[model samples]
Target: MNLYYSFGTVLLLLAITAPTALLFGYGGAMATRSGVAPLRWFGKSYIAIVRGVPDIAFFLFFVIALDQGFEYLRHKIKCPDWNEPIRQGSDFVVCTAAKLPLGNAPQWQHETYGFMLAVLTFAIVFGAFAGNVLFGAMRAVPKAQLETAEAYGMTRRQVTRRVLIPQMWVYALPGLSNLWMVLIKATPLLFLLGVEDIVYWARELGGTKTPNFTAYPHGDWRMWYFLGLLVFYLAFTKLSEVVLSRIMARLTHGQATAGGEAQRKAAA
Candidate 1:
């Protein structure tokens, strides 16, 4: 039950967040290519800043800040009349009632809340990378395609919707697929965000302590536990590659890109 619960939590969190990241990424890409200078700068800066940071640094920084920020807001809303001090030494103390999801909530609620936070963090960090991929893909789209759309009496919006976005995927998939792979690899970071993901449980279950504990208690075995995690990640990446490759083939069909040309030649 624990195994099923943990895996389900991770999968559900990923399903919600991956799409969110993709959508934000697409928006960022479009913004970067906007005709207005300010919009372009805004988009480009977003992509640039995120891409420039180490993923671990961003993860640690954002998670702590966001957690504290949420608690602060709760303190203001829930304890406005009773505050002595929110911070004392290294402790951030909110009134017991203000604890996120609350200490008295069921175990499931705490797990759910932690999972939600992990999803948000993943979406934000990966969205920036996705934005960079998407921006480059948008630019890689042929200028001629846009010009032709304009010549056909299409409005700018029509040109973008009918031509630019559709074709941009063919260019973007390679980069987006790469980003997806990175996102998958980064899932282990969920442990840092306080979710007991597979890696965390694996370590816990595999650890050896004493006969005073149980039959499984023996010696240090962190290496094998981590090796299993490595195997799981490698398998997941290989499966993802297969799926993305098929999508790539579908997207490339009849397009004016090299990938499309390869498909045409193969058909011939």
Candidate 2:
């Protein structure tokens, strides 16, 4: 059923968005800690701005801004002759050639484009939070470890790659775990991004009245449908907690943190 398929849609979004966000966050975190002043400023500004703004507002505005931005650039390249203002009142018009999916593209293409936008929006928003977490985690690594690495003739880059990067994750795991839960809860926002995620399908299929023409009509069942979604999310979070707990245990083993200390005591 369409509703069942929407479940996959939500999962696919998570699969794509998680790594992409982590990649963006890693870059931002590295930039924040970079020796170059401008890169550091840019990274700090990115984290502050994105994390400060309300996520719903960003979701509502950024998708349109990004889509229009792409169109504007394409218009310049594809429609140099058309001199009409792109901001004619509230409408954004562009040449047919400049249309993102093209005017006559299939329905799937339009849906794909919308899904991509939703994924990018999620990545950018969550990435800022991840960057902040990572930045703190990097600082939390013991300075003495870095000193020891340097004493052994390791270069700064070598120290970072071999020592800092490996150890920071133990500190960062808790924050990243929380972020993952937040990301799971935020999947319903795909509806706002024009992606027909589970929430959308739930509403559409659970309504009491059928459309003007429909094969099946039912009583008001939106409550039951939403209840199912609640269960789905609850199970997902529970599973995540189990998996993250295992990961934390594994990562903390033999490290100097409290988790590692506890793990060592248990093994002994």
Candidate 3:
């Protein structure tokens, strides 16, 4: 039962993370393309720094730091009476109320808290990659169309909304499709965040069980479990490729890119 639930956990993480990450990427891309210098620099820096860091290192470090940072803030607010230092010769201390799930939290609460952290971490990491793809897509928009919009007395914002936004997707879809595939592959990293995802279950349930632990003690079956996982991922990505290709065709139907050119030639 737990193993079955782990499959849903993987899908749920993808469903939530994909849109949230896209929102982050969109914001970052827009900032990098903005007229304001600081905003542009911030966007570029976020994309470069996060994307450059190895995923496992980021997962190990960021989750702990973010968890501690939250507890520290809560400790200051909820345990002001304490005079002891938070850092006690290397061991960090915080009030019971400051614990994210509370010390006596139910098992489900702890799992939920861990899952939330995983989602946020995934979003932050993948969003940077998505932003880079989108930034390049934004630049890939032809200068001629933008200049034409300017000459037509269109404001920068208007040109962005009317022409730039709509057209960039044609160029962006291929990169974004690859990013989506990468995101699917990265889902196994949920284990690092302490979330019991499919990979975790495969290893756990497939391991040999002692007679004391269960009546149905069995030999190691990890290979079969992992093979099932391989099939699941391959099928999912194959379907995604088909769907994304269709979307790409739709986006490029009348545009001026190579995909569009091929599409027009096919129609003719």
TM-score of each: 0.86, 0.95, 0.93
Q: What lDDT, from 0 to 1, does candidate 1 have?
A: 0.82
Please report, in order, the local distance difference test score of every candidate based on alpha carbons. 0.82, 0.93, 0.90
Rank order (by lDDT, best first): 2, 3, 1
TM-score leader: 2
Worst 10 residues of 1 by lDDT: 1-10
**lDDT score, candidate 1, position 200:** 79
RMSD to the native, candidate 1?
Answer: 2.6
Report the lDDT of model 2 for residue 189.
Answer: 92
- Candidate 3: list runs displaced more than 4 Å: none
For candidate 3, the TM-score is 0.93
lDDT string, candidate 2, 1-268, tens digits: 9999999999999999999999999999999999999999999999999987889998998899899989999999989999888888977889889999898999999999999999999999999999999999999998999999999999989999999999898899999999999999999999999999899999988888766557786788999999999999999999999999999888887887787888889889
Evaluate residue 94 in candidate 3 and report its C-alpha lDDT on the 0 to 100 scale. Answer: 92
Decide which is better by TM-score, 1 or 3.
3
lDDT, model 1, position 155: 98
Candidate 1 per-residue C-alpha lDDT over 100-167 given as tens digits, one digit per residue, 9 for 90 to 100: 98888999898777777777778888888888887887778779888999999999999989998887
Off by over 4 Å in 1: 1-5, 35-39, 76-98
Cα deviation of 66, candidate 2, in Å? 0.8
